[model samples]
Target: MGTKGQLVTDPRAAALASKAWPYEEARKLLKRYPEGKPARNGQPAPIIFETGYGPSGLPHIGTFNEVLRTTMVRHAFQAMSDAPTRLIEFSDDMDGLRKVPDNVPNQAMLTEHLGKPLSRIPDPFGKFESFAAHNNAMLRDFLDRFGFDYEFISSASQYEAGVFDDALKGVLRHYDAIMGVMLPTLRKERAATYSPILPISPKTGIVLQVPVEVVDADLGTIRFTDSDGEVLTQSVLGGQAKLQWKVDWAMRWVALGVDYEMYGKDLIDSGVQSGKIARVLGGRPPEALIYEMFLDENGEKISKSKGNGLTLEQWLDYGTQESLAFFAYREPKKAKQLHIGVIPRAVDEYFQFRGNYAAQPLEQKLGNPAHHIHNGAVPAANPPVTFGLLLNLVGVLGAGATPAQVRGYLANYVDGEITPELDALIDHALAYNRDFVAPTLVRRKPQGVEVAALERLDRELAPLPAETSAVDLQNIVYAIGNDGGFENLRDWFGALYETLLGSSQGPRMGSFIALYGIDNSRKLIAEALAR
Candidate 1:
């Protein structure tokens, strides 16, 4: 692969990168699924994966990220094999409502349907099957726009279509062990926080606890008691439908043929319980990839019920799909502050990889990692635009303005003539708009300039070509950074502000100029100076 300078020259690290760890993880999971079994045909069955788009709120980026991570690996496999790999994105719509999600039209629906199943809600979109359909539609739209390939399997569809009939019967046969394990799972108190889970009948409202024996296999009948001995009712209550999480985890690996699965760090319990279920029920747990949590702009883990998640729709306004893809590929290893701010870096790295990919020749492996992250290859880059202008352009464009409209508004102050180099930039913008909603806010107005430096800037820059080199521009900007009676580094900081951002402090000025077009950079800073 190619790099900004020379190839990395290290064979071992290159080898390590060639088979991305995530892909390996997926392969390991295959061994645990029925598809992993040796066969004459040697063709693997489809892998069924699950995700819950809770109605507690609009599905956010974290929601999409979880699903996308699975899709990413799925793509890796598809790329490598002539064979088919099926992935199913499941919705937990048949479950009951624990709380109301933000932005949903009906708040009263929660109490009105208090004990009713989530699958029974009326469709808000008026076209979908039910309330769950509207919420799922938003998620589906995002997944499709972002290019995720997955089969949509809803709880309503699974039950109504009777996909769980056999599994349900198996669950009844193991009902005793299910109750034996779940009842004590609660009351870990003082040390562990357990929210007492119990299954109840929706029609009877009878708490189905103790010997969760054959509840009505049909006509909706079943109940389970929580730690508080309160009965909870659910229409779809059975081993398969209401399989105590651990057993359910194992069963899916067997039933749907999921080979690989990844979960957040906080879900250790689910992972542990699923491991147990695998041994007892399906006889094997899916391959596990534990991911780290995603923090907000303020470094807080995003929570849907808590109204803290920033949806994928919002992040798209400031970033591209490739940027988002790269972000997912890189993160989930450690917790880092997240916000619209992370987009630029992801975009830059993606472009760097693309540049390298274009210049280098390498073998394509279906199960191999993207490897570009380690190959020192430069990714395709979206030509640089002024950050301020980008923010503004996206600001208006993000508000559902068409690309043509965005182009018209951008033409007003983007004084320089358009260049073919920026075609990539336009494409990135289009993808961002087509994928996500506008962010609630942009990065703190990219980190403020000095009047003395500003005054010198106009003259300093006047001699340059309308389209100048970023480095050349930055060099000129810093050459005079020590102006205006300055004696120390602090004094020169103003120059960085003037040339790079029209502020006294900002990103590394040279790096900033290199990424942002010189002309647009000048225009933005000049306007800021005029203020």
Candidate 2:
């Protein structure tokens, strides 16, 4: 790792450190901590990079994107600076459960716990101590699965342990200023009842949003009216109270000295409000990157409560984790539609970038998404076959094609023995084809000139040897299409795909024939003509 005032020696790392988005983020950190550490109370402290999670529901793709992107930036910073750093995967387990999500089970049981902190509610799954603990474990499991290096901190644990005591005091001291920053953002009704602190009700155990009657900054206590119309005073420290989310965000920045964080574009206004509160609390808000949000297939914003977007598990079922990372790494500022239909393209593009990494020049290699996805440890070789080709192979081979049969046919095109990567790709292709492709396939019977052309093409292929090259077979098909009185050759190819493959779009006819065998192609043509 390069130290302060030390030049980056490796050309590729230097190029990437200067060009990649992660490195661009890293540069901001370098500016934040010029001497390799931030000064805290006249003592040097390790720089903190934090990602927040709301354990109100299961960890979704949005959670993964934040941590993954943050990790990328952390890695880039590590490469460019010798400063020690900490990545805190913070979970807001103390957050109130506003309502039941559409996805989880035991809805009635969860609904009963509404308005309580997630950590105080019983787990619906019955596997953990509380609902928040269950979701927190899930968050750690997936992050560990991705091999992310970080520390997990729960909000309930931190607050109950008095880790936020000093910060809580700071919040009490700046209560009026924080309220001044927050009130203008809320509607009249909400602003009327809003307080910087939400006291957990002593009798009902619900987080309350009542009006504060008195504030004692000196004693770290506040007097508020309970839902029963009783006046109560409680210390705001420890687990007695939690700040409103926007104020809590600022308090967290003050408590942890967070140096850098990123949020969705939708939170741009909230971020500004939190920054103002942070300033009021005598702390600087962290530098932030506002990336565009992911949208569902219908272009609606993906929400965890609605469970509208694809989960990490769903994406992993059909594509490699590296492919998903590649998707997250590209043009994060631009909105991208995330759905099952995008998997094949993402998988193919990932392999293409990986395959091209080695031969690329130093600058180009650094610029490639694969380099960052792999942390500069990109594999030397990738599977030669594309994900699209594999899907088409599965489609043409019919529903009963076993894995062994797919491997057997793949041997004809692959020069060397099949690698494990190829085997995994084949499995993904099989599942995707079975679930997504087969149901949508519509085979249309050839009509008009298409019928005669296909017959002529089948007859023309009969004389060709089984071992003919794909190029030669392609030339024969192209010639037949050209001479068969079809004004547009694409129509002939379309007819071949629609009639023979049962899809309007497919792999190269030459390659499909070579893999499926000339006899099989002829039989397919015969069957289509007969139909």
The top-ranked prediction according to TM-score is 2
Residue-wise C-alpha lDDT for candidate 1, range 1-531, written one tens digit per residue: 435655544543333334565556545544454344443266544554555455534567777778777776665454333345667777766665656655556567544654345667666446766677777787788778766667887765765576765655555555555545554666645213221123544444322323333556454444555446556444443422344345655555656656567788988887876666555554556666788898888888877657665567656655666567677777467886667657766666666555445445443322222342322333344344543334434543354656566455445434565555454455455555345424442322222235566566667766666556556766776666655555765656644443333332355554444344345556655665555
What is the Cα-based lDDT of residue 43 in candidate 2?
64
Instruction: List candidate 2 segments past 4 Å from native.
Output: 1-9, 39-44, 105-108, 213-215, 304-308, 447-456, 478-489
Q: On a 0 to 100 scale, what is the lDDT of residue 419 in model 2?
A: 94
**Candidate 2 local lDDT, residue 386:** 81
Q: Model 2: clashing residue pairs?
A: none
lDDT value, residue 101 of candidate 1: 52
* Tens-place lDDT digits, model 2, residues 217-269: 76678899888988999987789889889889999998888989999999999
Candidate 1's error at 261, in angstroms? Answer: 1.7
Weakest 10 consecutive residues of candidate 1 by summed lDDT: 189-198
**How many pairs of residues collide in each model?**
32, 0
lDDT for model 1, please: 0.55
Error of 2 at 484 (Å): 4.8
Taken over the whole model, the C-alpha lDDT of each candidate is 0.55, 0.87
